[model samples]
Target chain A: AQSVTQPDIHITVSEGASLELRCNYSYGATPYLFWYVQSPGQGLQLLLKYFSGDTLVQGIKGFEAEFKRSQSSFNLRKPSVHWSDAAEYFCAGVRGTSYGKLTFGQGTILTVHP
Target chain B: DAGITQSPRHKVTETGTPVTLRCHQTENHRYMYWYRQDPGHGLRLIHYSYGVKDTDKGEVSDGYSVSRSKTEDFLLTLESATSSQTSVYFCAISESGQNSGYTFGSGTRLTVV
Candidate 1:
C-alpha cells in the first residue's frame, strides 16, 4: 500500500533550539512530496514542496525539507525554532501515477518550550 | 487566503439531520477538493471535482456526497449526519491537475450532536 508516515506524534524543543520532524513514504517510485503547517483554529499553509530536481527545498518561515531517495524520507528541518512555530505539521505526497489527490501522514504536533 | 472561502466557519447539527457545507473560490481554478480532518488520521479526501460536473470518490467517501454545478462553487452534503461525521472540513483548489499543489480555505468545523 502507498502511504506516508510521520514517526514522531509529538515533539518539544526550546524556543531557540533546532528542530527536525521526520517523514517517510512507502511508494513504488519517487512521489511528489510536500510539507504543510496548520496553526490552531486555522487552515493549513504550505511550508514547502518537492516535485523534482534539488533535494533540499526552502520554504516560508525559515523551514526546509530534504528529499532523500535512498531512505524514502522527506524530513522537515528548522535551524532555530520559534514559539510561533508551535503547531501541527503534516507531510503529504502524491503518487506519480495518480490524479491530484494526496496521501497525508499522521501529523506531528510541535511544542515550543521557553 | 482571500481566493478561497468556506461558509459557516463553524456549525453544529443533530444526528440524522441533513447538512451541507459550501466552498466558494474566486481563483477560477479547474479542480476542487473536499477533505475531512480528524485526530490521528490527518486529512482524508472525501470528494473532488475536476470540472463543473465531474466528481469522483476519494479514500473515505462512503458517507459523503459532493456537487459542482458552477465553476466557482463546490458543495458537500451529508444526507444524514452521523456522529462519526463530526470533523473539521477543508476545501482546497488547484489551478490544474497532476498535484502541482493546492490552496486551502480557512476550514469549517462541523459537529454532530
Candidate 2:
C-alpha cells in the first residue's frame, strides 16, 4: 500500500527564519508528489508538484520542495518564513500506475512566532 | 476555487439522520473525488467518480455513498450519520485522471451530534 508520512505533527518557527517540513513516502515505483497548504477558513491550495522534472520545484509564496528518489522523500522548504505562512501543510502522492487517487500525510501545523 | 464549489459550508445534524453534501464544478473535469479531513487523518478518500454514473469506492467508504449524474455535479451522502462521522469534507476535480493534479473546493464542515 502506498502511504505518505509527515513526521512532524507541529512546527514552530520564528518569523524571518528558515523552515523545513519533512515528508516521506512508501511506494514500489516513482510517484507523483505534491505539497498543499491550507490556511484557516480556506481550501487547500497547491504549493508545488513533482511529476517528472527537476528535483527542485518552486511553488507559490516563495516555497520550494526537493524530491529525493533514493530517500523516498519530497520535503518542503522556505528560506525566510513570514507570519502569514502559519498554516497546515500536507504532502500527497499517488503511485505511478494509479489514477487520481492521492495518499496524504497526517499534515503538519506550522506556527510562526514574531 | 472558482471552478469548484461546495454547498452548505457548515451543518449540524442528529446522529442516524441522512445528510447529503453537494459538489459542483464548472471546469468540466473528467474526474471527481470526495475526501474527509480529520484532525489526525489529514485527508482520506471516501469515493470518486470517473464519469457520469461511473463511481468507485475509496479507502474510507464504509459509511458514505456518492453519486455523479452529470458532468458538473458530484454528491456525497452519508446514509446514517454518526458522531464519528463529523468531519470537514472536500471535493476535488481533475481534468485528467492520474496524469494531472486536482483542484479542491472550500470544503463542507459536517457535524453529527
Candidate 3:
C-alpha cells in the first residue's frame, strides 16, 4: 500500500517570500504524485501531477515540485508567495495498481502574511 | 472543472436516519469515488465505482454504501447516520489511466445531530 506523509502541519510565510512544503511517500515502484489546494469550504483544485519524466514539474499559481526518487519526496515550492495563497495543501500518490484510488497525506495548512 | 455536481451543499440529519448523497458528472468519467474529510484526517475514501453497477470498498467503508446505476451518477448512502459520520463529503471523478488526476466536486457538508 502506498502512503503519503506531510511533515508540516501548518506553515506560515510572509508575502513575497519563498515557501516550501515537504511531502514524502512510501511506494514500491514509481508513483504518480499530485498536489491539491483547497480554500475555505471549497473543493480541492489540482496544482500539478507527476507521472514520469522531468523531475521538476511546474504547476498552476506559480508553484512547482521536484521529484526526488532517492529520498522518496516530492516537495512543493513557490518562489514568491501571495496573500491569496493561504489555503490547505494536500499531497497524494497512487502506486502499484492503484487505478484511481489516491492515498493522501494529512495535509498542510498554509498561511501567508503581509 | 470536470463537470461534477454534488447535491445538497449542506445537510443536517438526525442520528439513526438514512442519508443519501448524490454525485452526478457530465464529464463521462469512468471512475467515481466518495471521500469524507475531517479535521485531522485529510480525505478518507468511503467507496468507489469503476463502472455501471460495479463498485468496491475503500479504506473507510464500514458504515457507508455506494451504488452506480449509470456512468454519470454515483450515490453514497449512510445506512444509519452517526455522529462519527458528521463530516464533509467530497465526490471525485477520474478517467482510466495514469496522470489523469482526479477532479473534485464542491463537497456536501452533512451534520448529524
Q: List model 3 lDDT by residue over B3-107, tens digit each.
A: 999998999999999999999999889999999999868998899888999999999999999999999999999999999999999999998835677899999
Expressed as tens digits, the lDDT of each residue in A32-66 for candidate 2 is 99999999878999999999879999999999999
Residue pairs of candidate 1 with colliding backbone atoms: none
Q: lDDT of model 1 at residue A105? A: 96
Once model 2 is optimally superposed onto the true structure by TM-score, how far is the C-alpha of residue A106 displaced, in angstroms?
Answer: 0.4
In candidate 1, stretches whose alpha carbon ends up further than 4 angstroms from where it belongs are none
- Using lDDT as the yardstick, the better of models 2 and 3 is 2
Clashes of each: 0, 0, 0
Q: Highest DockQ: which candidate?
A: 2
Please write out the lDDT profile of model 3 over residues A1-114, one tens digit for every residue. Answer: 679999999999999999999999999998999999999989999999999999999999999999999999999999999999999999999884765898889999999999
lDDT of 1 by residue, A1-114 (tens): 789999999999999999999999998988999999999999999999999999999999999999999999999999999999999999999887666788899999999999
- What is the Cα-based TM-score of model 3? 0.98
lDDT ranking of the models: 2, 1, 3
Q: Candidate 3: where is the Cα deviation over 4 Å? A: none
TM-score: model 2 vs. ground truth: 0.98
Instruction: Please tell me how candidate 1 rates in CAPRI terms.
Output: medium
Please provide TM-scores, in order, for all candidate models, with all chains considered together: 0.98, 0.98, 0.98
Candidate 2 chain A, poorest ten consecutive residues by summed lDDT? A94-103
Worst 10 residues of 1 chain B by lDDT: B93-102
